[model samples]
Target: MGELFQEAILVSILAGMIRIATPILFAAIGELVTQRAGIWNMGVEGTMLMGAFTAYFIATATGSVWLAVLAAMIAGALVGLIIAFMTVTMRVDHFITGLGINLLVAGLTLYWFRMYIKGRAQPTFDGFDNVAIPGLSAIPFIGEILFDQRLLTYMAFAAVPAVWYLLYRTRWGLELRCLGENPKALDIKGLSVSARQYAAVLFGSVMTGLGGGFLMLGFSDRFLADITAGRGWLAIVALIAGNWMPRGVLAAVLVFALLESVATHVQVLGIDVPHQIFLALPYLASILLLMGLRRQSRQPQRLGIPYFR
Candidate 1:
């Protein structure tokens, strides 16, 4: 009985990891897309907060969660466009611009929240349901572990295939690579460098925004002050650890999620583990992953260097 209990507990731990990974997976893949195009947009935390706030507000006002999701994506795209124009077209310093955008988004969300919510601590969400695949749900332990999740979680899972296809199989993908690698060369070949970068940045930001909304509507069922809690930074690190590939990022996200989920469970279940040490697990893993892998991956030579070409 003791042995079986430990086995069940281990299975539960794995399940919890997958559950926590849902949002990080989305954000990491989105940042992966951004970095692949030679841009590092670090404002993901703020964008996520906005997404969360927007999703909750729209859901509350209209009682339509779908609309809230749509709104969050649209809002994210608009913000992405703004960043693209500044960083991609204007040739501004990418790091400074990204940092500025993050601060702007964070302040704006908080300001609007106070103005609209009348200083309420948080806005609530009815959120989405945990959906299960028909035949897939019945396949022993692995089935429930893999198949049952919220719609956003499923969407995050499905996105891996789509992202891989878009980045690897498409002609547009080649152009994006060329733009990041040698924008001047692309310009000489008559390809529009800024146009491609703009698209990539905006697309990346939209994914990030959806990730934020996912936290609010899909996971937390509410919005609170500064609720992103540095998860955006984690997403950025996951992108690096994955070497900016969709498939790799999925694994990276799962690993980090497991660390966090383990920490949360140990803390909540009164497992007698040092709370501080466990709480630091995910972050420590990210740092180690970055240190270990960065030496192996060679980023685009022109990355974050404004592309006038």
Candidate 2:
């Protein structure tokens, strides 16, 4: 009986880990794309909040989850463009600019929510439904574990390979990488550095937007002020821990998710641990994970540095 209970406990935690990991996976992948272009966009947290709010409002207004997602992506893209215009096009410091964007988005989201949604926790709405993969979903423990996830979760996995191919296997990726490593080189080759940088930033923002929308339409059903809850920052760190590869990022997200799952399990089992400490586990673990590997990890050499012609 004891052994059977333990087995059941393990499986339940694994399931929860996958659930919590979905949003993290989405945000981390978005950050991965931005960093690969040599700029660290730290406004992801604010952008995510905006995405959540906007998706919620649209979903409430239209009664269409799909339209809410579309609006969220557009919102994120515009926010991304603002960052790009400030940093890439105008030659501002990427860090300072990103911070400003964060502040701006936070304030704006709140102000608008007050005027429109009247500062409610969120506009009430139903969220997306989970999906079970055919055939694969029935295959014992692993099958049930892996195949019975929601749509966004599957996309997060699919994004791994898709980003990998885009970043490492294509001509555009070649040029984008060149822009990151050596913008002058791309310019010398008659390519427009600012344009490529703009594209990278905006493109990265689309992912950020999707990550935020996933929270509304995919994971949870509502929004709160600063609803992203530092997951955006975690995603940035995840990009580093992932060694900046899509596959690596995915693995890192999974590991983080698993830690979060265990933390949740520890609480649920009524263990004699500080609830606050367990709550802090994911962030603390991320910091330790980064510190432990910082010496060995290699980041983009030109990261956060803007290039001038």
lDDT of each: 0.77, 0.79
Q: What is the C-alpha lDDT profile of model 2 across 176-274, one tens digit per residue?
A: 777667778888989888887888888888888888898878767766776887778877877877778787788777777777677667777777666
- Looking at candidate 2, the ten consecutive residues that score lowest on lDDT are 1-10
Which residue pairs of candidate 2 clash?
A: none
Compose the digit string of candidate 1's lDDT tens values, residues 180-276: 6777887898877777888888788788888877787877766677778878888887777777777778887888787777777676667776767
TM-score of each: 0.93, 0.92
Off by over 4 Å in 2: 1-5, 119-122
